[model samples]
Target: MSRALGIYIHVPFCKQKCVYCDFYSLPRREDQMDAYAAALRSQLFETDFSGCEADTVYFGGGTPSYLGPRRLAALLEAVFAACPIAPGAEITLEANPDSAGDPDALSALRRAGFNRVSLGMQSADDGELKSIGRVHTMAQVRSAVEAARKAGFDNLSLDLIYGLPGQDLPRWRKNLSA
Candidate 1:
């Protein structure tokens, strides 16, 4: 019998680089999006997944949401074509609030087989977010959550950062509560 595998797709592009990020990623390279998508799809289609079934597919990286719905959908389509996905598979996309807080885009992603979203909330406090070079604000986070819910995403997660350079206990607590 074949084994069920958890697939992780890495997107190495971002709108801008974060000060504290050490990940190997390209920032401010929107021009390469189409080329990157095409290359990724070619790679996915050429991979050998002979006896494996994808039970979970996670799209993570510099900010998967930066790719937008159409590009993401195309990549996901390639994944579907190349692999045998199990029924009710968990397909997750790691998104940034700024780029993903749109009802229409979220709906498109949902229709493209993304069942879960991990939003990079970082911090609810705008100051902390700026300190870390995150472009999204608390308001955007809220909007993203609402949009995700409206798009029929039941499985949603948030990514938070604590203990920044000037972050105090009170501020951290506020982040936890907000």
Candidate 2:
């Protein structure tokens, strides 16, 4: 019996660095994208997966969607070329709504084989969004979600933060309701 494995890719870029974020990320640098993509391809090629059959490929990080559609497509191509991903593999990408304000990016991601998308919505209230320094507004988050659905992504997840400075149960419930 062959053991199924998982592949995880980390994209370390964001449109803007958040105040409370402590992840590996840098502000968007268009010049660095191509070089970073090449490095990622090289890394995938160098990695040995001789006995592993990947059943899942997760693109995570400071903001995987920060790479946009083109880079993400290139990276996915390189990964597929490097390994044999199982049929019906769960390919997921983490995104920040602010970074993914463009609907075309989400469409391209779905076309490139990502079946799942995780969005960092953080909060549903305008004040909370501002307090957390999230670049996107609550309206933007809703729009992003709608865009993802329109892009044919049925498996979508949103990330919310609890235990925030002023977040009480009511706020949390309201967020949940939204």
Clashes of each: 0, 0
Clashing residue pairs, backbone N/CA/C < 3 A, model 1: none
TM-score of candidate 2 relative to the true fold: 0.94
lDDT of 1 by residue, 1-178 (tens): 7799999998988988899898878998889889999999999988999999999999998999999999999999999999999999999999999988889999999999999999999999998899899998999999999999999999999988878888899999998998
Models 1 onward score TM values of 0.96, 0.94
lDDT minimum window of 10 residues, candidate 1: 159-168
- Candidate 2, residue 150: the lDDT equals 88
Supply candidate 1's per-residue lDDT for 112: 95
Residue 17, candidate 1: C-alpha displacement in angstroms: 0.7
RMSD of each: 1.0, 1.3
Relative to the true structure, how large is the alpha-carbon lDDT of every model?
0.93, 0.87
**Candidate 2 C-alpha lDDT tens digits along 31-106:** 7877888899999999988877789999988788878798999899888989888999999989888776666878
